[model samples]
Target: MGTWDSLHKQHVDVFIRINLLEKALLGLLQNRATGDMKGAASLQKDFLKAFEQGMILHFAVEEEALFPVLARAGEKPRILISELLAEHKSIMEKHNMIVQTAAVDKDKILLELIRELADHAKKEEQSIPSIISQLTPEQLNNIDQDAKRLGYRL
Candidate 1:
């Protein structure tokens, strides 16, 4: 594949994984919210695994690799990148809370985390295409390799 096509594929892969995780989290939230803890633990386990395996990597790629590209794009993009980073911090905090707490009704916090992550993903979807287009072929390859090192399938 050509450079732009390859870059777009890798970038889109991250979004696809994020969307899957969000869907799983939302299902878990619905089950937990209903007080139906039957398979909730299993769902929780899977969701947690996905978060550990996927979401963290996505965050690192965006912050470490992609955000710098956006930052150089100018003031408005830099500001948006800053906002997205701040959202990641908050979402991570909630994720930590969800992982550490065994208390009942923690699905509430999981729901909150899902909402925060979904919003973050939407903001990224809006800005990432522009950022990707601005990157050089070498830069995109570096990003793809970095993301792979972080355990991204793409």
Candidate 2:
């Protein structure tokens, strides 16, 4: 396989992590809506921890490694990366809000946050593959190294 193909496989792993976060968020939202406040609170805490460690780290790798190569390839990576960062900010705000409002009737807010996260994951899954397909082997190796430095396994 080419370098891009190998890197694309690594990106798929990131997508799996994102999907896991989405599922956790969805479960928390459901529990919140169903009056399982205790369960919701616990799950929300766990979700936040995972999000910080997993999803955030994945994005950091992409921002530091993948996006720059794509930008060098004249693929509007700057704009895409900027948009993704903005979305990450928004998601973080919503997650914090959900944690703060867990004791209150904030089921709707939780649902909205979960939905937003799902959307963001979908966008990453769709965009990264095509971008990866265009990258050279050396570019992929750089991304793999960056991901490793960021504590991600290929």
Candidate 3:
């Protein structure tokens, strides 16, 4: 496959994986809100781990490799990419807050985090594909390597 095509596939795959993680977290939140403490606790642990591994790594890859390529391509995407980065920061803050507040009413905090992450993921999925399409083969290979260095395969 061409470099851009391979990168596009990677982007789409990451989007799908993130969406799945968001859905899983949302389901956990729903279960928590319904008073399923045991179920909520179980899902909360898994969700937290996934957020750390999947979401954080995904953002790291984008910030380290993808966004720079988009920014260098043209000014048109800079603003949107900046906004996405800000949203990533916000999501990270919320994730950290939820982790910190877990000792007191962990379920409620986790539910809030899940909602915030889901909304952020939706925005990212909408914007990232277009940005990915603009990258060159060299850029994609750089991104792939950066992600690999960060311990993320995709």
Candidate 4:
């Protein structure tokens, strides 16, 4: 076989991380908050703490590295990248809300967070093919390194 030019390491890495986040969200969302209310609240709070930590790096790399490349590529791409950047901001805001919500309102906040994140991630997944096609392996590698520097693994 010839050299495998389609070596998309960064895309694969990001996808792995995204899949992990999706799994965690699915578990948290499917379980629903119940039984010992305090226990549920504590569980979600802990899960969210970890999730937020991971997403900070994830969002940074996308915004700081990936989006800029896409933004400069073309007008339609710039528009889409801007929308994604906005979504990143929105997701962070919602994440903060989830973290700050009172115990009594925790479940509702989690549900909303879940929905918003699901939508954001779905859009990202849909855009991945275009991104991979548009960006060179080296550029993606730079974004991947940036993500790693910000503490993302997988």
Best by lDDT: 1
lDDT of 1 by residue, 49-124 (tens): 8778767866786777667766887788889888988999999999988778786767778767766776676677
Error of 2 at 86 (Å): 1.5
lDDT of each: 0.69, 0.65, 0.65, 0.60
Q: Pick the candidate with the highest TM-score.
A: 1
- Model 4 CA deviation exceeding 4 Å by range: 1-43, 101-104
If both were scored by lDDT, which would come out higher, candidate 1 or candidate 4?
1
Q: Tens digits of per-residue lDDT for model 4 on 1-154? A: 1011122343344345444444444455577534444554455665576566555766776777566776877888888888888877776777777667656555556555656666676677676557557777787677666556655563
Better of 1 and 2 by TM-score: 1
| CA displacement after TM-score superposition, residue 42 of candidate 2 (Å) | 3.7
The C-alpha TM-scores of every prediction are: 0.72, 0.67, 0.71, 0.65
lDDT (tens digit, per residue) of candidate 3 on 1-154: 4333444554455455455555555666565445555554565676678667666767776788677777776676888878878877877877878777646655556556656655666666677678778777778788777667866664
Q: Of the candidates numbered 1 and 4, which has the greater TM-score value?
A: 1
TM-score of 1: 0.72
Poorest lDDT segment (10 consecutive residues) of candidate 4? 1-10
Clash number for model 4?
A: 0
lDDT of 3 at 61: 69
